[model samples]
Target: MPSEAKSWRWRYRFDGKEKMMSLGEYPKVGLKEARDRLAEARKLWSGGIDPLAERKAVVEAKEAEEREQQRRAESSFELIARDWWARWKEGKSRRHADTVMSRLEADVFARYGHRTRHLRTSSVKLNGS
Candidate 1:
């Protein structure tokens, strides 16, 4: 991202034709959003599409996907928990599975004396049994 002459330029090229596209002036866009936009534009070019128009479409589509994911995250806690439990059940003993279920029900949500969710899902609910 280049700021020059009171306008912001996102520089790029394709087919040996170098160019700088105006991405509006500063205070109108942030550096992170601009970089993300550039990445999507390049992805479209690699897939054989025009970059400029595809950049707009990609932003809109990406926003929609993000919104949808946020909505699902807000609405589907139980479903997500069940999905997690199903996966956890895949490689653990019955005793371990029981310990995990107990922890979840107890809201401990962690391995014994551990606070992170990075524990092995298999036998996550470990039991001496």
Candidate 2:
């Protein structure tokens, strides 16, 4: 153990190479947890799984999950509807697009507000112009 002014870490030799792993900070980790981590790393070595590789795999999986959740949130109805209108309005004159949007707001969106909670939860279909 190096007496440097940094967090306590575990180091060991494996396959003729020296490896280092953080057991966490000194006061927070304590001696017991560091020992536990050392034993765990040894167990990983015996099982033929490199501790560093295992940690990398776990981090990748967590990041992938977060990305998937964010994609779903971005695809929600309110956002998609606004995007669709923005694109569809581009080919039409401003006055015509505004007229069509106002009609939709008055006829379609207005109905949703007065609907019963149960009715609002059901599928809403818009007629194609």
- What TM-score does structure 2 among the candidates reach? 0.54
Candidate 2's C-alpha runs over 4 A off are 1-5, 82-129
Instruction: Give the top-scoring candidate (lDDT).
Output: 2
lDDT of 2: 0.71
- Over the stretch 72-121, how does candidate 1's per-residue lDDT look in tens digits? 65445454565688898988898988787777767633323322333355
The lDDT of each candidate is: 0.66, 0.71
Where is the poorest 10-residue window by lDDT in model 1? 109-118
Per-prediction TM-score to the true structure, in the order listed: 0.33, 0.54
TM-score leader: 2
